[model samples]
Target: MYVTQASWKSEIFQVTVGFLPDRAQIGALGLVVLAVLASWVVKLRRRLAYRRAVRPGQPVHAARYGQGRGADHLGAYAPQPGPDDTRA
Candidate 1:
């Protein structure tokens, strides 16, 4: 098979290449779908594994804090005041 390169001085050749249908477009879409499915399966497996790692009646945070639920067990989402904040 002979391979030909487009020329910079030719306007007709540029138009031909510009209008050419991309054959790999379907393959690229398939690859993207496969990747998304793989990621979803991985995330689901992780969640199932985590559920298996815990027993009934066990607090979800017990492993991290080594303690059961309490009023003081504020999670990481607890708000913090910024240095420039003027609120009391």
Candidate 2:
């Protein structure tokens, strides 16, 4: 009788831990999502901190191109006001 009971208990344990445990899968997926979300949050925080360290009223041209003559050509794409401007 003791041997029969031990066999039953082993079978039960095996089934409980078998393939496709809903709770275990959910827990594992939740951990993966949490890790990805944490990494994204840290990356965004670093970007915002860098943006803040830049002084306000600093022209984008000065910061990026260092007052080069490229700023002269930067406005070449500016659209001229057309006769249809007042209609909008």
- Evaluated at residue 82, the lDDT of candidate 1 is 75
User: Which residue window of length 10 is worst by lDDT in model 1?
Assistant: 63-72
The whole-model lDDT of each prediction reads 0.66, 0.68
- In candidate 2, what are the lDDT values of residues 1-88, reduced to their tens digit? 4553458866765565566478985776677689989999999999999997785986564435445343345686745547976522
Clashing pairs in 1: none
Cα deviation of 10, candidate 2, in Å? 33
Candidate 1 lDDT over residue span 1-88, tens digit each: 9998667655664454556466655565567689989999999999999998885886574346555344235667645557895643
Give the winner by lDDT: 2
Residue 13, model 2: Cα distance from true site in angstroms = 25
Q: What TM-score against the true fold does each predicted structure earn? A: 0.39, 0.39
